[model samples]
Target: MSSFDETQDFVVVGSGGGSMCAALVMRSAGKSVLILEKTDLIGGTTARSGGVMWIPNNPFMKAAGVPDSLEQASTYLDHVVGDHNDTPGASRARRRAYLIQGPRMLDFLIGKGLKFSRIAQWPDYYDEAPGSSVPGRTVVADLFDVNRLGDAKSLLRPNFLNLPAPLEDVMKLPHVKKSWAAKKALARMGVRALVAKVTGKKYVTAGAALQGQMFLAARTAGVDLRVNSAVSQLIVEDDAVTGVVTEKDGKPWRIGARLGVLVNAGGFALNQQMRDQYIPGSSTKHTSVIESDTGEMILEMTRAGAALAQMDATIGSPLSLPPGGEEWPIKPGAQNVAAAPHAILVDQSGVRYLNEGGSYTEFCQRMVERDKEVPALPSYVVFDSDAMASTMIAGTLPGARKPDPWYEQGYLKKADTIDALAGLLAIDPAVLRKTVDRFNGFVAANKDDDFKRGARAYDRWLGDPFHKPSETLGTIGKAPFYAIPVIPGDVGTMGGVVTDEQARVLREDGSPIARLYATGVSTASVMGRTSPGSGVNIGPSFVWGFVAANHALTVAG
Candidate 1:
């Protein structure tokens, strides 16, 4: 092993949102920081996500006239994330720390030149829960000009969609009435791109934009980033983490840190062995996270006496894999399409198991629950031609005149009638027909007696606003029914090394490991098994990163 001569004040082993936040803070605090990323790209799964942050009472929310308080946010967390606090890794203190410091950290980042806008229409996952907000406490990053980063932009991970506007603007595309308003939006976007190109700018939006902004901020703060370096082990001295050994260029290099080592290397979503050992389902091929996240840092920390928690949990969702068994670089889940109107999910028995309009996480959880009784390994999303023509389905774009490749490849089954479709799906024809008839009755009555779909504000938000009576409940009466197989996929695994309120990694005895900190998916998620809102995954990550960096800075002083 080759040992590096230089010693930094802090060493961050990952380049996700959490590590970026921590590196920014440490650099701002005038500390020598080194960021080591295993992959060539700088951003991790954060670049693949929606890039929204669920920061209750954030300055953006306040500016938008959204009412929120710490107490109210605490109550909401208590209601949703209750009992999980009693678990080994989760605690009430960590939850409070997340809620209290989240907005402050976001505001700090905003002050450091990160632009964000409030998502006023996004509802909390459980809006009916105590102290929940109808309009969520989520804020998404504004579109960023990646040209500001110049050549550095190439190092950033690409998002699922490369739209050159904010996500809010992108969401309006489906609602645009094909009139001048729609033409104007598209024209404006094109003009913006043209202008940006003329001005030597490259604008990116959503998660890509968020990471671009963060990269710019970190660069401005003079963070030393080293990509293609994977941390192999933590260097411990007197029971305190002092450095790390990284594998780079087919060699091992040891680097020292004066303050601490922050483990933010993400989860093991792509690791099949870990998934099989922890997650409920057997398949590990369909995660929505980047392939580089294989829990290396978590394993290093665990070897150094760190405790683990919430190992069985994941931010699960239902996803339709690509045809011909070809995997994309980044797999995008069919979340919105599955929740859209006229689409009903059925088990192998051709029976509806849960509300199709529920949150993606809950939908996957229900699939897992149903799998216990029946072999619902691959659930079917049954929809009609109207749904296929009116909106996107299983990644199929709207208004596509031709049949999808999935249909031609047999990944999607289609028939002129529900019974025929069920026959094609190898399901009981009578049961599927009865299920569709019952669902149509529920749509006509504007009430779901079976699953209570479209009852919550969140469900309605994901539904068709133009549909009468209910947004999420519409009849699947149109001919040419279609069925697509959906498997349990995850945004990322949520469990990892356990940490305390200050983001310090802890031992099994609940004692902190000195000079060792963790943030993001490297540690047990503070949200536990519940996802409170759209950005819950990223919100606490930012806060904990800030907390960890500040604490390490104090130690350095």
Candidate 2:
């Protein structure tokens, strides 16, 4: 089983969008590269993601005649994230670097083979917050022909669980697409899928569309992918990363890197122990991370003297299913469309704790605080049947198949009175009833007096487009009441080993872990504090991958 592999120029750990893109970028530069993935699948969290990218002031926008500038993007970033360097100076630096390079990195990808179809109508997450751009900043990869990566197929996994409908279909809805081109693209995908499937063709997921394209780009350039390869630890010599000692197919394998190893193995959202240590109250609710994301690679690097930042922060929205429901226990998995209603997210005390329309990370932070302030993480989403009917739950789509990981798995309780629903959730029944009554008055008035939810541009973007009086304001006053016990669920954790702006992993003392690089969720997310816009997660991932690859090629690692 001893493969005894020779030294590679660059070794990348994890197959998420970041790892794949970085590997491709390196390979394109004629650098010797080896990508190691823990799972047999190549796509990590990337395959299960929305796959859109927010590359502000990108050339693609300019090509499409969309008006935007770097200055405007910087203004937007300042307005949304500000200069919150709470986690030492690392957080602020990472944020600034990401924002500055996000556009350039995206342009580099376009120069490669990656194509971006503009989601022209998709607004910045905080369009109204400050200097946000309108139309065309968010871009998705053109649907890929996964068949291009022949042998890579066995190494890649598609997201068949979480998102029930194809992203192409979902974005085609009236509220989503404000342009004719997007509508046409949606139609084309439908026609193509039907034609391709009838001819016994394999389908490509949105996550796959982005990652597979990167994989194919790398492979075409002769990049090496080492599957079933697990990095045991970093080979740190003289306070710098020289190489990595890994196990391949059950045998010790050491790969010397002249440049460095990029630890993009992703965060520990899927690791229960790490979740408990970092996000205590939400230890059990993170549902969107890949199973390989145990943070083992991160822990190994930490042991080799890497510094972790924002370790305590996690990101997730609220959701729940029925008791004894296999799928409802986690947050990212359970699609509680209840938030579309005027229902408020409440603590066990039955009091609202956060702006219902805030980003997932902010919500999780508040949920953790609320849980600590009260008792447990049994936060509830209080709504009624009317809201339930019109809202679109994440996993409960119309015609998707069974063995659905997020199917009807949590309590979908209903009661004639608000008090009864509160009783089911074990909340202070009187307080719960009163909160609902107050929320109802606001809904009737069509305004969010407390949080001013729909009052913001980002909230309105994800709000009910049909509800005219107030896109994000609705009441639970209609007949049968509902209360789904929500838990703090995360798509994944977004921090890891420190790295420089070039995506090179760095030591605790601000020294480079030579030839070592990290990107995606494996690095402190480039999006700083709150999630700025749609695709914030994947945009920087692709950009960093490009940077790391180019840097490695030039460094002789």
TM-score of each: 0.95, 0.88
Candidate 1: Cα lDDT at 459: 89
Ten contiguous residues minimizing lDDT sum, candidate 2: 398-407
Q: What overall lDDT, based on C-alpha atoms, would model 1 receive against the true structure?
A: 0.82
Segments in model 2 whose C-alpha atoms lie over 4 Å from true places: 1-5, 88-93, 134-136, 161-168, 172-190, 198-200, 323-336, 397-410, 427-430
Candidate 1 structure quality by residue, lDDT tens digits, 375-487: 78788889888778777655556753545676678887879999999999889999999999999898889888988888899888887777767778878988888888888
Q: What is the model-wide C-alpha lDDT for candidate 2? A: 0.68
